[model samples]
Target: MTSLTLTRGATDTRTARATGRRTAWVPTLVLILGALYCLVPIAWVVIAATKSRSELFSTFTFAPGSGLLDNLHDLSTYRDGIYWQWMANSAFYAGLGALLSATVSAAGGYALGRFAFRGREFVFKLMLAGVLVPGIVLAVPQYLLMSELDLADSYWSMLLPSILSPYGVYLMRVYASAAVPAELLEAARMDGAGEFRIFTRIAVPMMMPGLITVFLFQFVGIWNNFLLPYVMLADDTKFPLTLGLYTLLAQGASQPALYTLVIMGCLLAVLPLIGLFLVIQRFWSLDLLSGSIKS
Candidate 1:
């Protein structure tokens, strides 16, 4: 009787294992299909950029064309190499805006997380409301405000607005609350350390992973932002990559030659973001992403 019972249990376990493998294939297949759907467009753009003007319309969409160098040369020479200028502008705005935004977020979030003050929650909630507000709704008013300040059509107009990200603050707030220990702060306080020193020496390092995540997000937002910069800056020289590519596309409607340049410009534009992610991926811990880190 014991031998028979053991045999039946082993058979059941093997059957369950087989069933689990069969059931898992469906979700795996679905995920693969979703991934392809997203990546196909990017693949098309990369292939499309290689084609010359004549070949762009003439060749098969996926077929690689021979004018990669030629297209790059045309893009570089277009309007005295203005494309490079736009790339630089994007880097400046995203880099500086993200840095300042991250700093402000860290401070605000740390304060909200560590301190018990009057209306602290209210202040944090009010700032968080900014995240729910769409950028489009704020753009016109922001433009008007900047215009009134005589800062419209300038770099400051774009840079200043991007430096206060509510989401960044929220992320830092949550992260600081969890990642930083009250005991550590108390110890520092007992040792006669200033608030700023405690934050810089202890909080910042412990919160580095979260802060890097916030910085990457803010940087991407500022980099890809089009409508804000469009409404603010009138000069092409001040235009970021998004606006620059947009203007190029508008021109391409009349002059199809510019389409190749637009495609090439897009391919070039993504490289910086990819590089940024590769550099910062190490700092953004997988454990944090998995929701294992809690406040």
Candidate 2:
């Protein structure tokens, strides 16, 4: 009877082990499927961009074609290189807007995180509410406001709305609260440092990671923004990549050959974002490492 009991316990242990191993695989399989789901479309765009207009529909979906150079040459030369103009516009909007947003966010967040004052909670809560309100909901109101100021259909219209990011402020606030020590600020004050000096010299470095996060988020948001620019700008000369590509797509509906250009444009559009991530990721890593060491 004791032998029988021991044998049953061993069998249960083996069963549990097998079940755990199978359970572990479930999450792994799910992750793999999720990755493929996201990656397959990107892969399709890359492959399709290589095909010429004829091969775009005639060739196999995943097959590589030999027209990548031709597509690029055509896209570049199309309508006096307007594609590059769109690229430049997008870069300017995203770059300058993100920089300004990050600066404002850092200042607002540092103040909210470090200071004790009247209505501080109220202000932070208001900003949090702003974060919850979708940008789409505010687009029309923003357009009306810009129009009242007579700034519609200009670069200012594209940029002015992007310079303030409630989400970026919220993120920086949380990060500053945790990352910037009150004791350090006290020490700086004791050493006769001005508030501005303390912020620029001391607090900024400590909050670098959060700032970078905010910058990247704001940059991507402005880069991919469509509705705000669509509502504001009528000129193709000032349109960012999103609206510019959209115009190409609209034209493509009538002229089927433009579809190839659209595909090629999409592939090129993805390159800047990829390069930005790769470049910023290095700084992000270094900041994290420095932070860990400082801690």
lDDT of each: 0.92, 0.94
lDDT tens string, model 2, 1-295? 9999999999999999999998999899999999999999999999999999899978677879999999999999999999999999999999999999999999999999999999999999999999999999999999999999999999999889998899989899999999999999999999999999999999999999999999999999999998999999999999999999999999987899888999999999999999999999999999999988988
| Backbone clash count for every predicted candidate, in the order shown | 1, 0
What value does the lDDT take at residue 58 in candidate 2? Answer: 82
Question: Once model 1 is optimally superposed onto the true structure by TM-score, how far is the C-alpha of residue 5 displaced, in angstroms?
Answer: 4.9
In model 1, the worst 10-residue window by lDDT is 286-295
lDDT of 1: 0.92
Clashing pairs in 2: none
Candidate 1 lDDT over residue span 1-295, tens digit each: 9999999999999999999999999999999999999899889889998999899988677889999999999999999999999999999999999999999999999999999999998999998898899999999999999999999999899989988888888989999998899998999999999999999999998888888888999999999999999899999999999999999999988998899999999999999999999888865655466446543
RMSD of 1: 2.7
Task: Rate residue 117 of model 2 by lDDT.
Answer: 99
